[model samples]
Target: MKKRLDLAAFRDGILSGSRVVLGQAITLVESALDSDQELAAELIQSLMSHTGRAIRIGITGVPGVGKSTFIEAFGKMLLEKEKKVAVLAIDPSSQLTKGSILGDKTRMESLASDKRAFIRPSASGGTLGGVSGKTSEAMLLCEAAGFDVILVETVGVGQSETAVKNMVDYFLLLMLAGAGDELQGIKKGIMEMADALVIHKADGENLPSAKKAKASYQNALHLFPSSPKDWSPKVSLASSLSGLGLEETWREVLRYEYQMKESGFWESNRARQRINWLDEQIHYLLGQAFLRDSKVKQTMDHEMENVRTGILNPGTLAKKLVSLFLSTERPQ
Candidate 1:
């Protein structure tokens, strides 16, 4: 029999920046067990005072845009500056195997070995967005664990970008040279949400093309309405091979943080995110409670089959299920 995890020990270790305990804390939050969820909520409540100190940044790009490479270089640079970095890489789960491939430690060999950096790659698990549902929770845990910079890398499959954008302080879109915006398949709305656009793989012959792409994106960004933060979006070229644009990109991020903080937008944005998180959790918990009710689950298949066979209407089935769930003892 395994020893039960001590909540106090977890809390103390996290507040003291113990990576081992931090990993366990994240696992607790990600668990689907009722017991674990109860413990996770208590842990979050205790650690709430220690969170909100880190700079949360979401990094997304089109496939083949060298996202992992960029993060490797970028994270190493942050570590060089003595910043405590935590990367939550949201890996795209395979439809066939239902497992993640991109979050493997080999993808970020250098940064994974660093003492000041913590990297966690989580399977998206068919979540609506590229991010795992527990990403926000994990981020708060990281902050409580004393990480000052949190980098969230989305699956970059297009639809999940918006979900990641809402959770981060600054959103970065990585692009490749040559392909026009439309041809590249990036959604217009995603571009609008980005605080910066980084043209990746800008070494050797790609440098000129990267510069041209940078200019084009800068022009395109100018056409959009100004951001609420009063900070103009920036475009820069980056290359992991040559390490050309790491410094400038970090500088831009720092400048954006400074400007947003001065305008009070930083704190306001985080407050709004917390409210949004609350709403999301309510919806999720309600759905979970509905499905977990024994009465509902016992009738679910029958109701769905009725709807499928056209014997019952969808709306009628939903009402019946809701009523049945209400009759049960709901999870507290």
Candidate 2:
């Protein structure tokens, strides 16, 4: 028989900064089981006052952009300054098997081993946003547990990458130097969303190219309008191998944060994020409920068959399906 988790004990343990209890709380919130979800909601509600204290940053880049390496070095630097850091690393999951590489723990060796840092690498689980489905809840849990800095790293920049950007206080796009392509594999949309861009691999041999890339990016950013925060996005150079530019990158983030707070953009941005999260969750839960309705499932399959055989048009079938679902659904 499974033993019940003591909610009060867990709450106190997390508030007291017990890593073990914090890990358990994170795991509880990440679970998709119905029973666990009730407890998770309770846990989050209990810890609500303790959250939103951490500086949240979302980092993303292409495969070879050295995101993990940079995060390792950057997280270590923060830890050295007596700040507790939490890394919510999102790994790509397999479409066929839903399996994940789950290698961030191994990739971020130094930070993973550091007592001041907590690293949780989650599978994307085929989520549309380029992040784990429960990342926001997990982040709240981490913040409640006393993490001063929370770094969210996405699987890679793609259509769904904006999901992470919407959730974080700052969105950082890392790029490789000398890609030669004018856009360097970064889409204009994603590039515009970045609060800052760091050209990685700015070491000995790559120094010249990194500097050139910085100049090009700076010019391109000039063509774009200032961010809603009223601050112009800055581009910098970084080298995980040489540790050059890391401090500068951190400084840029701090500076941007300071400006946002001074302009009241930070509070408004967080408020907007909360509304977005609520809307997204409502859609997800409604979809799940629709799928779980046996009557709706049967009606949908029947409608799909009619559409497949050309007996019914898609628009008519969709309307009929929605009516059926609404009729059959139980009121909450």
Candidate 3:
């Protein structure tokens, strides 16, 4: 029988640059099956100090916007430049089986084949943010394993993107020029998170359409004024399939980094994300603890039954839930 996956040896394998072990470690973190969550948590603590070196870029877009395809192209380019790229993709999985659509891996076949790139697809599994508890921790593990670029790809257009933007140094929004599409389709708050907007799949038959979309985006962007750094958001068109306009996109990312550093948004953003993360996790833990109380559980059941019977008002039900939360002394 195979020995249990050894944590100590696994840790050493990470430090020693063993890709096989690195893959296992990443899988452990991404798979939040109830049994592994605690072990993954412990491993992340051990790997904490080794993180933060990678340039974390988070990419998101609406469904069918080619996020996976763009990542494949972008990742391959980085690999050709001899950079080790690791992708932590957060996409919802089937609740029953807890596996992603697995489309990311399929789209990123080339990147997967590259020696310099590591791709891990994580099942969101009803996770609100589409990120598991160990995402940041896994990032640290990847950084420690010597990956130069750690890419956190999240499901687009909602809480998932918001969650990813909080953790990454740069947030990238990918757009496409479908028939008569408008910026109105994307929420303003999500657009505001973007450090840059890339018009993806800009090539051949799509080039002219992409250009028009780029102009429209530029016009829409003027409405946001400038970022806190006095930097106007950058917009560009790129063909992930044809490898066109990639270099400029990379340059813009670097420029954004420089502007952020110069204007102190770098540290400021990181600090804010830290506080936000702390608060979010605290609230989550508190809610979990509050619900775990036997009394609270019974109350919830009663409340739901009351709602079903039309005896309980929604507002009153919410109040009762909040009271339950408030009454509980949450453990730190």
Identify the candidate with maximal TM-score: 2
* Residue 93 C-alpha lDDT in model 1: 51
Per-prediction TM-score = 0.91, 0.92, 0.86
lDDT of 1 by residue, 1-332 (tens): 65757889989999999998898888888787779989998998899999998999999887778888899899999998999999885644535323242445478888888879898776446455323458888999999999999999876375567777878999998999886654556888888899999999999999998898888888988999997678888899999999989999999999989988998999999899888877777777788667778889988876788889899898988998999988886447
Candidate 3: residue pairs that collide: none
Ten-residue region with minimum lDDT total, candidate 2: 96-105
| Tens-digit per-residue lDDT, 50-103, candidate 3 | 766788899887777777788888888888788899988665443532334254
Better of 1 and 3 by lDDT: 1
- Candidate 3's TM-score: 0.86
Give the per-residue lDDT digits (tens) of candidate 2, residues 221-278. Answer: 9999875568788899888888888889888888988888998999899999999988
Task: Note the Cα lDDT for every prediction shown.
Answer: 0.83, 0.80, 0.76
Better of 1 and 2 by TM-score: 2
Model 3 segments more than 4 A misplaced: 30-38, 92-101, 129-132, 307-310, 313-332
Model 1 segments more than 4 A misplaced: 91-103, 123-126, 129-131, 305-312, 330-332
Worst 10 residues of 3 by lDDT: 92-101
True-vs-predicted CA distance for residue 14, candidate 3, Å: 1.8
Report how far off residue 41 is in candidate 2 (Å). 0.2
Model 2 has an lDDT value of 0.80
